[model samples]
Target: MHAISVRRVRRSLPRAALALVLAALGAALGPGAAPAAAAGHAEECSTEAGPYQKTVERHLKLTVDGVQSAADCAAIRTLQTRHGMEPATGRAGPETWRIVQYERAVADPSALTGCPHGTRLIVCVDLHRQLLWVWDGDHVATGPVPIRTGKSGYATRTGEHRIYERVEKQWSELYEGPMPFSQFFDGGQALHASYRNIWEEPGSHGCVNLRYDDAKRLWQGLRLNDPVYVWGTRGP
Candidate 1:
C-alpha cells in the first residue's frame, strides 16, 4: 500500500476557524448522532435533455418521453442537487442516473445485494456503482451515500479489510492537505471526506472519498476493527 494523497480545492475558512468549527461540532453532538447538512442555495435547473433523459424520467415517474421538459428538469434537478451531484443539471447524465440507482437501492435492503450483513458493522464499498453503505449486521447504520474511489491505475483495493485507525482530522504531509474523518482501513488508503467535489472526474489516489457530512457521520457511526468489504471494478 502507498500513502494516499488527495488533491482538493481548499475552502475559504482559515485553518484555525475550521478547527474551531469541528471542535464545536464534536461537543454539540453525541457519538453516532448525524450532523445537519450545510445550508446551500439550490442550483439552477437544467432544461436540456440529458443523455439518459428517458431513464431519469421513468424513474422520477414522469412521462417516459425522453424529452427534457420543465417539470422533468425540476424533478431531476432536485434529486441531483440533494444528492450533491456536480452541476445539479436537471439533464439526465451518467452520474445522475447512477445516483438514482443508489437511491432506489438504498430503500430496498435486498438491493444491497453483496457485502455480508451480520450483527457487526460492515462497511460496503461498491466501486462499480461509486457508492458506499454501512451495514450493521442486518441494519444499515449509515451510508448508501455517493462516493468517489481511486481513479485509473490507482484503483481502491478490493477484498475484506478492517479499519485500524481513525483521525477526526488528519494531515497529509506528502500532499499538504487535510483528510478529515479519516478511517484508515488499508495502509494509507482510508475512507475520508474530500475537500473537492466527490463527483468530479478522475477520483482519488486510492482512498474512498465521501462528502464532508457523510464522512463525519461515518466517523461517528463506525469504530476501529469494523470490517470493510470492497468489490467490483469502477465503470468507465
Candidate 2:
C-alpha cells in the first residue's frame, strides 16, 4: 500500500508541474492569452476554394486560378483581417469580395461628386456604394469605409441632414436592439454600430449601420450639429 501511494504521488508530480508552468505562463501572458492562442489557431488558412475564389484572386492580383493555394489564402486572409472581416479564414467568400469592391470605391470617393467639400467636417454617406466618409472640406478626414444602410421600404433618407443626437450606448425600444455609438442624423435613422454582419441582408431599419470599430472612431471625431450628407440610391 505504501509503494502504491508513492507511485500515485510520482504520477501526479508531472501533472502538477505542468499545471504550475501553465499558470505561470497564463499570468505572464495576461487575460488575452487564450484568445490570442485561439486567434493564432484560427489563422490557419482554409483549404477549400470559396465561391468567389477566382474573383478575389484577380482583385488581389494573385494567380487567377480558382484553386485555394497556400499563398492565395495568406494574401486573401491578410485583406480580410485588415478590413475586420469575420472568419478571416483566407476564404474568398462573398464578404471578402465585397470588401475588395469597397476598397476600390474608396480609392476615388471624389468621383461620386455628391459629397460637398468644405472646412466643416461632414459625414458623407453614399448609398450607391454603401460607403461613408468624413470630408473636411476638399480632403477626406476619415472613412470612405464600408457601411450598411436601410433596406428597400426603410431607405436611408437622402439629401442634407445634421447629427442632432449622440448616444454612446443606445437601446431602441422600437426595434428592441442595441445601437452603440448612435449618431442620429435624421429622424429615427442614425449612424450606429451593429453587432450583426454589416453585409447581412434585409438590412437596418433606416439607420446607417457601421462596424463597431468604425462607429466608435466616428463618434470620437464628430460632435453635435455636424453635417451629414447622404445621396444616391442603395446598390443591389
Candidate 3:
C-alpha cells in the first residue's frame, strides 16, 4: 500500500472562544439517525437550486438584508430547518446573522488523495472547510463533507492530534443521529461525518466530522498509525 501524506489546512478546530459541534452523538432521536445523503445531488450554496440551495439561502440571509419579506423569512426558515437549528425567532433577528457567520467559516481545501485498500495507513481531516481528504503520497481524493456545527454563539473545539482509533455505528444522546466516533487525543472529539439539512453546512458539536461516504472510504483505508491534524475554525 502506498503511503499518503498531506499538509492539512493551516487552520485548526475551534477553541473555547467560539466552539461549534462538528459531529457527535445523535442523542434523543427515537430510533435511527438520519443517514448521510448524497452531497453533489443534494443542496449547496447558490442563487439557483439543487446543491446550490444552501448557497442561495446563505446569500439571501447575508446579502439581501432589510425587512423580513415572506421570501426572505422563508429562506431563513429553510436554512434553520435543514440544519436542525432553531428558527430565527420567527422574526429573523440576531440568530439569523449568527447562522450567516458560521456559514462563512468554510474555506478552500488544502489537499486530498486516497491510498490503496491494503495500506491502511494514515488519514487526515480538516474541520475548517468541512472537507474530507484521503491521501496516498502526494495524491488524494477530497469529498465535500457536511456537518452540524454549533450555532453562532457556540463553536466546535479545535487542536492537533493523531488518529489512533475509530468506532462505527456509535449512538449518542448528544448527537442528532448515528455517527462514527473517532479517537483523537482528548477522547472528546471524533471524526465522523454529518449532514446539515439538504445542503452541507460547516456545523458540528465539537468534533472533526466527515461525510459518511468519505469516512467510509477512509475508514477502510486508514491504519492506526495514520496522521490526523485539527485546529480552530478557518480564519477570514
For all predicted structures, in order, the TM-scores are 0.76, 0.65, 0.43
Better of 2 and 3 by TM-score: 2
Cα TM-score of candidate 2: 0.65
Candidate 3: misplaced stretches above 4 Å? 1-122, 141-157, 173-177, 181-185, 195-202, 232-236
* Tens digits of lDDT, candidate 2, 96-140: 766876888677664546788777789989887788888887777
- State which candidate, 1 or 3, has the greater TM-score: 1
Ranking of predictions according to TM-score: 1, 2, 3
Clash tally, candidates in order:
1, 1, 48
Top of the candidates by TM-score: 1
The better-scoring model by lDDT among 1 and 2 is 1
What does candidate 3's lDDT look like per residue over 1-236, in tens digits?
Answer: 11111112214442222222212222333346622432223233223223233444555645443444456556666766654453222344433444444454334333232223234333444444343445555444443344333334445555445665566665444443555534343344556544323122334445555545656766666656566554445321
Candidate 1: give its CA RMSD in angstroms: 10.2
Cα distance off (Å), candidate 1, residue 12: 9.9
Put the candidates in lDDT order, highest first.
1, 2, 3
Q: List model 1 lDDT by residue over 1-236, tens digit each.
A: 23655655454564346556766775678665524432243456777898889887888899998998889988998888787666676878878778777788877767786687777778999988888998887888886888888888888999999999888888877667789999998878899998777766777878898889999999988889989999998864
